[model samples]
Target: MDKMEIVEKHKLLSEKIADADMVLVGVGEEFNEDFSDIGRFPHLMSALEEVDIDQMLEWTVPFLEHRFLIEHNDGRLVEAYRNLYEMVRNKNYFVITTCIDENIKKAAFDTERLVEPCGNHEMLQCSDKCCDELYPSGEFSDLVKQAILDGVGLDSLEIPKCPVCGKPLAYNNILCEQNYVEEGYQRQWKKYTKWLQLTLNKKICILELGVELNLPNIIRWPFEKVAFYNQKASFFRINASSYQMTEELSDKGISIGMNAVDYLREYQHL
Candidate 1:
């Protein structure tokens, strides 16, 4: 869009925030700029494809390492969250994201006001989720690094097994949803629910960035429901393609078709 149009949208969003008692931001899959993709890690994908059996960690261990190795201090993900924080910093706001990366924390967002229910890459849990415990994910990453330095294949190393069930260990994310443990983010979920309750009948601003159908129940559907029910709420949806608001909410929210990252970056810079 043109500069004047961009400025107009920014002005509208600012007005909504300014008039609200509570502000909520929902970040979805697009926020995960570092997430593994064939375009970004073709070798990893090829490795997984060549394996006969489930050689997931062959891909996963390296995946975690790749995510951790990135210096977020100057990365786009950190910059996006930082730009977003500046707009909502002064408002009574809470941020929720499906991304498991630690960039939000790196952006210095208030821990008490942010939640990531999809799980984090830095933590591990039993593949079967035999217990509520989550282990540090660094152990497997270290093993992968050592093997790389030793010029040996990962097959030569023993993957960490779950202590409770003797099953394989996995990242604490939805990929292991067969029996994913929720303890890591359950408390924060409760806090988020309580915060939502407080928004009822109050002036609120809801901004959803790059959200999609990946977990509609958690964000998309609920956000639309809240916006429709709360007459005092103003909503904005930004995405490259899936920015359409529900017909019921079209009058109440603004849906802009654009890349969320680009929009945030430009919005901040301009």
Candidate 2:
């Protein structure tokens, strides 16, 4: 797209996104990798090579694994996580993140995943019974489906079957791990999905922040489709590479090759 066209579409996108009833935010590790103090921890990586979920679930693991990454003068890791969490929690937004580490999940939920040191403090309580009251998040479900699509076996996915009923296990609707079984959590997640679906059919703007083609199509495809269908539904994508939009979507979608944080500042007039 031309510079003039890009700027015009960006203005439209800003207006639409600002007025959107619901915005689906997909949390990614790119921002963390760029901003995290830790490059890599050799010892922690070696320790995690054992592939023991139980051992990894120890209370000390999250702190130890993320110790290097979280080191920053302004507590950047924690603050960024909290800021993103609060943004989604306060706005009509739903977050979809990959399960790369326990610390990321904890930061996303603002709650501990391990039950060893702080058993009762875990966000989701367990029933220890076989109940069909659990649901999984679209993000989590899409991850599993994508893994399988990428040639991962069901067993290799690290999901365990139901212990009591011997049935297939599902991530409590968020598709994190097999052990993610919480009815309450699933209920809330479903609400987000339902809201997103409803909003997609309406005229809305999508702020595709820092998302790239390397990411999954779960969010991108739908956003593109919406922009294509509705002339008023503008789209904005901020990346390092020069932004490009589909020929059909170019009129409504804006592609900006710039940092997302910088764009956000400008967009918000901060």
Candidate 3:
């Protein structure tokens, strides 16, 4: 699309955002740029395929922790997240994301207003399920940072141990075969469920940002259902590449093939 078309879509989206009583933000990996190269699933698996399954498991856990904690910094919080914070700060809104990054939190979004089903990198859990407890990752993150400062690699750092069971601790992110602690996720899900029921007939807008069809069953399809069933609701898609809505939502949906950050930043001034 041309510049004018992009601007027009933003205007229309802004209008819908302003008119809605509540905004439901569905986010994906595209929201953060720092780990864009690391990739997900098959791509990540290909990179680690050389290592045996057992060795890969040993390397993958801490590798992910270092990626989010050591490599990523607050500087990566782009203008789009900031502008989005401004747009929804005073307004009634909730965010649902599949990413484990802390970009949204760093941007000043309320913790109580977010639901992260995929977990986060700032926490850790016992590997043996010794207890249903999660430990803060600040100390571990600091250790990793210190190791990097000393020009040492992740392998040089000692793996953290669970204080209760004395076993190795693992990052609290959801893994393919590993069981994950879901207390925090369940709490957030309860809050989201309550809000969803309360706003069933209200004027709601689903702002799908950088979310593709990767895991449509989780947030994408559900958000589409709500927008489709609610006569007064609308779905606005902001993606830099593929931007589309189903036929049922063609009339109520607005698709803009523009960078999410750029669109939100432009909408901030408008």
Give Cα-based local distance difference scores for all models. 0.77, 0.46, 0.73
Query: Candidate 1 lDDT, tens digit per residue, 184-225?
Result: 888888999999999999999999999988789988998999
Looking at model 3, the pairs that clash are none
**Candidate 1 backbone overlaps, count:** 0
Which residue runs does candidate 3 get wrong by more than 4 Å?
36-77, 128-131, 149-156, 163-167, 265-269
lDDT (Cα) of model 2 = 0.46
lDDT tens per residue, model 3, 1-270: 688887787777677778899989988757654555344433334434423444624644454445544444444345677778876776689999887766677678888999988887767888776777988887877765565556444456667888997988776767522557776488889999898887778899788888876777877789889998888898988787768778999988988887676666666735
Q: What ranking emerges by TM-score with the best candidate at the front? A: 1, 3, 2
TM-score of each: 0.83, 0.49, 0.80
TM-score (C-alpha) between model 2 and the true structure: 0.49
Cα lDDT of model 2 by residue, 23-57, tens digit? 55543323433424333544444334433554533
After superposing candidate 1, which stretches have Cα over 4 Å from the reference?
1-3, 35-72, 139-157
